[model samples]
Target chain A: MEATDRNNREGLKAWLNPSRYGAERISYWLQRLTGVGLLGYFIGHVYETSSLTQGPDAWAAMLELTQTPMGHMILLLVIGMSTFHSANGIRLIFTEGGKGLGKPGRPDYPYDAVSLNYRQKSGIWIALILAAAAMLFGASVLFGGE
Target chain B: MSETIEKLERLDKKRKEHEKKEIERSSIYLKIFRANRATGEQAHYDTVEVPVQRSTTVLDALLYAKGYKDHSIGIRYSCRMASCGSCGMKINGIPRLACYTKVSELYGDTITCEPLSNFPHIRDLATDFTQFFEHHKDMQPYIQNENADIKDPSKLSEFVQSPEDVDKFLQFSYCIKCGCCYSACPTVAMDTKFPGPQALAQAYRYFADSRDAATEERLELVDDRHGIFRCHFAGSCSTVCPKGVDPALGIQLLKGHMLGYSSNEKKIADLKERLMRK
Candidate 1:
């Protein structure tokens, strides 16, 4: 369907375009997307691991797939996503638990508060840094020895 | 009986003729959503144009359509200024006060107006605000004082506050309860359990007030799974606020307070209680 047609359908579709909003909204969409990705990976991992019950031969065949570059790349993707998700999740947990939010001051005209703003932006930065670091480590582990 | 029937038919024909002429004279077309609550009929758009003016607002256009074109159009507005906040509706997919939105400012000839999202639509442009106001009331949007003597005005002492203290919640106090913040909120759209921006912001307003004695109670009210935590700082609430009431900021500040990160110097002091005890 055309984008306009889909948008005209009704209900909330504004969140799909985070660029139209601010940084925090983008973070919200990314968090949800990463969460779903992790869930999918978990189910796949469980199925792959359960192959051990089928016998040694079946388990060996399953392990053979991981030898391919495609499998290595997939693993890297998972590692990156998980690292970002976990880091961001911790930030969310702290925020929801009401931690690290500095004192409330008297509101001035054009009333704004920067404490939460700074914390949220920093949280995103932390998650990105952790994700990048994890991907680098995974790349070395996958390709360095090879 | 035949003569009376002929007379009734003549009157009906004249009215249709008059309507055709009226439509021809109209310059601007108002495309409005129409619905009937009694029949449970499906809602549909009806367009009718009215004469335009330089100072014409969306509310004026809607009023013209209602008075001159279609009587079935439903809308709620009073105090045509932005103050009443009763005329909040989506004009071109953006939530705005109808009274505050000028028709001339809208691009193109046709203006598409719809009821605000994230609320139950009562009819054409009117949405049910019962739930909205209930959330506002739940947060105790008023100043709570335990020791103020209402019976005798002479016995009460003035509560002195510095300029800095007023600044803490001054902008948040400008909220007209328009529900624009509520409508623009993605969290409210996704999660029904969320307390919404308006309520959480007002909760902070009173919480920040030096005169209000219910700071602790207010904090506990919003410090919950469905309270301020649900807000991911979408910022739409602040962007769409016509009154410049930054509800997003209020929610964050409230979160900061709950986390023991408050920066406000003057705390809510119970002078009466202290004096009486002395």
Candidate 2:
């Protein structure tokens, strides 16, 4: 049993690389997806604003098009991805600052004095809910009781 | 003459009692597992028994075994006082200087010594430090000042630094580069690209040095995935350092520097929160 426990500990140690490759891989993909989406949104937003150069009539027409079903769905996806990416980024910052999820003796958190993982997890849930709310609000604002 | 002789006899007996002190002086038998390079296999153990004195260091006993019993039993030593840093090997499964460790510290009559882990063994105890030093050189461990006007033989005054600044990097400069910490570091063991704590700490030492001008250039080199970010702060490097230089602290400080304004803003917010709580 002692040998089994020792082997388990060693196995965990071997997996927990200082480079944090597992977490990093997750962060990398999330960042890439969010970045592309955000970039596309910015470009489209700028093009829509460029409708002002056409006339105030064209500008209002561009704003009216944003109230469509596809526009609402894209905005929701953007908000969800961006909020997740940013929240996880902040969590990464806290992870290095000695904040992590789980109990003290848990293999994931070997030396956490205060529980950060739960808080960060809670923050993620809150951020997601808030993002969903914001997307709904944004759609409503654009549509205006339509 | 007779009285003087009696006094001398009393002194001799007293001296013997004090030095010997009735401590259990037993023979500690060591079975060292060495990898023979010639055959490319694990070498058989050659057990050597040496009298364990109270103050007798492991290096002293190894030397005694080499000198008296078996001349072929390989071991390395220089500066028997632990200053030379050559006698670093695994003493009972931990990397330490043989010169500094007493034989009595071992729990049992038999203790093992082996070459440092994850390094090519040159002999029974000596692992080649060439790769370690090569990595050190790869970090560009010197001041790279772009300022051409600062050069003058006499005009170069003592680089005025604060007491706090001097205190910060003082411990890092004491690194003997014994490769004990490097051997113990898990990052260096797994990844070839990730520069180990010794080199990273050395990089931090120069980076923190007020006189060094090329901060961004040096930071840029080690700012990547396999660089300073690779340090998970396992803290084995700090534990094994003979000089007590905390490479873990240095690595964390370097991480703090790399993260920059976001962390600083968080710190400010945390401070404000603390003040409000107070």
Candidate 3:
């Protein structure tokens, strides 16, 4: 089929474009991206810490890289990704635990009722707020330290 | 040629012209996906203009294309209404019952119709729902009662249920098994083994039933790694449901039930005892 052929040509990366779906889909994609980003950063951080076994000079070189502009930008990105991932992770925990879902009602006409109630929506808003707040705090500490 | 033969040909030409004029008056453009199973041909979109009114649905448009324009256009629809659930397809980018969606509601001069996503397409606008039904069956979507009196035909009585008990699974009972929820689900698209939202929600429907005796078993069925946990609460399934069946909410409630955070066990037992007394 043309649809199957189109999917094969595009590969799984087609779903990575959050514009294809709604806000919830965009949030889902962002959560996955941030998770991957944090995992990558965790591995790199662990590897950098293990370089201390190579002696003081190697450790000094790793520390010196953090002083550069590029390293500072990378650290900022790490902070941002971690904050978003952690905040969103909390939201997922609550949803998976079924904390915010309201009582089930009859399926009425217009079919406008949604599963994500006000509580779930507020949880998502809270996650976004917390992530933004953490980013602002991290930026202040990073730039303020001369 | 004979004069009589020439006169008959003239009348035939006039009839054809009148029919053409009538067709032009009510024609609406339908961009439909088509494929042939016997010829080993690849699928492609075919644009057919057919006579339609403002209230013409996608199913009506498809039938017009099939009956007048082209007989090769494949579509599956049992009832013209939304009850049968056989006419489920993707109209534009959203999954919906083609019979329920009016042409006026759809934007653009030419309406686009395709088979439901996350299912094996049999042909144009018709997907194989075998897997969907299989998943639904795997959940054992029915009330289970082990009571001897309930089993005996002579002893069977009405199982009294409160309005509140009915409210638990009432929304979920509206599902027509359309596969629209499965198509709209991103998790089902990513992982085929997730059983999709339709089955999981129906599982919860049965689980929440006060008359059901297999609540523990039903809970265990959907508590697997790829079951309720696969749902990330995307909320797209509920958005596209024509009957307002909120499978997303049902899945979460099932999660809550499995986690021991919510239950109406005592209430159900009391209802059952009352019914038994009668």
Candidate 4:
């Protein structure tokens, strides 16, 4: 009744859920989440950088806040999120431009989608793997005590 | 499946009777969402138990509930088979054709039947498909041939095409317009103006047909921001398709043609004044 315009639209709840849908939906969920996370980080990074214009102490204070163990963990999370976003984003770019998804054909009985071919589904897996690898490597470097 | 309870059944006569009752639970509980969406009445789940046979479908179960339990329980169905595509609803949290889904095929004891999401609920289990059909209509879901002359009823001319060409768009052509794919789509759940998987797939169906000539024009229709590009390839549309019409594949291939990846450049040609002169 409240939604007379759209009528029971699932909205963000459906968009955030990657469980029921296939690999692409998982990617969809990851992409949107990471995009938002990255946007927040970008704004914070800009503010962090702009602290240098205030004074040397402000810059040092900003560094002290961000260069700690907790900050490193947050950075690690950001790294993982960004890696997933970009990796999945690349896959999406190719997919949206129609590269990896296979050609349409006569769907056989007990049908499996040719559209969700090995290449397309694997893209989500590859993005996740890439994100994991980046996070692990970033963890080693960030927390290596250099 | 009965063997799992056989061990306990042999323990005692009481246990055997209990096991028999367990095995022969003839009626299943259907937790159906009841609401007159037009009237905006209170929405609630009406759990109704209907006797089911081996071959009884979800549609049959609903019909029984409507007939015996409550005549006011509203439902829309036609052609008790899956072809008509009318009796599509969310059965056990998945969008499916009720006639196509047997009650035995459902997993749990209480099968949840609700009107399909992302559609305006008409009554209890029926949803209005006006928007969905409008999107289908917007796609111009028909062959647009520039070279055809219906001069004589006796003399018929067919557009020459190979079987290989038919294979390109044949799967997408199987769409019954049940709205199962549309309801399952995450993009459709979010964006209303998006042509949805069905229309987009049908757009590709006609686009890929060898007999159809309007390629650039069709591509132009779906190349907008809210068109094919809005689809993030969630693949749920393909997952829930009742007739195996892979709308995701069709939409992607449609995107390929839209972005010049597949290189479709067909256009309308000028009609000849006379067939004999040409």
Best by lDDT: 4
Residue pairs with backbone overlap in model 1: A102-B261, A103-B261, A103-B262, A103-B263, A104-B262, A104-B263, A106-B168, A107-B167, A107-B168, B28-B49
Name the best candidate (by DockQ). Answer: 4
| DockQ of candidate model 3 | 0.22
Q: Which ranking of candidates, highest DockQ first? A: 4, 3, 1, 2
- Residue pairs clashing in model 2 are A100-A117, A101-A117
User: Order of all candidates by lDDT, from best down to worst?
Assistant: 4, 3, 1, 2
> Residue B171 CA error for candidate 2 (Å)?
1.0
DockQ of each: 0.10, 0.02, 0.22, 0.48
Which ten-residue region of model 2 chain A has the weakest summed lDDT? Answer: A104-113
TM-score of chain A of each: 0.81, 0.53, 0.82, 0.92
Reference-based TM-score, model 2: 0.57
Cα lDDT tens digits for candidate 2, A1-146:
12222111122243243332223323434545676788888898899899999999999899888668787777777777777667656655654443442211211101121222346446546655666677677667655664
lDDT values for all models? 0.76, 0.65, 0.77, 0.82
Q: Write the per-residue lDDT of candidate 3 for residues A78-136, one digit (tens) a residue.
A: 87777777877777776766667667876545455555566656766777777778778
Q: Residue by residue across B1-278, what tens digits does model 3's lDDT show?
A: 69769966776776566444432225568888776544556888899887778678889888888998898788899998899999998888678899998776665678888888788767777787877899999999887876526557886657878999899888899889999888878778777678988999899888888888787788788778888788887777877788988888888878876777676574557689899999
What proportion of the real contacts between chains A and B does each prediction keep? 0.14, 0.00, 0.46, 0.65
TM-score of 3: 0.83
lDDT by residue for model 1 over B179-262, one digit each (tens)? 888888888887766789999989988988888878778878887888777787666787677877768777876776677665
Q: What part of the reference interface contacts, as a 0 to 1 fraction, does candidate 4 reproduce?
A: 0.65
For every candidate in turn, the CA RMSD to the true structure comes to 14.8, 17.4, 12.9, 8.3
Over B85-148, each residue of candidate 4 has an lDDT whose tens digit, in order, gives 9999999878999998877766678899989889977778878898899999999987776555
**Model 4 per-residue lDDT at B230:** 90
Q: By summed lDDT, which 10 consecutive residues of candidate 2 chain B come out lowest?
A: B261-270
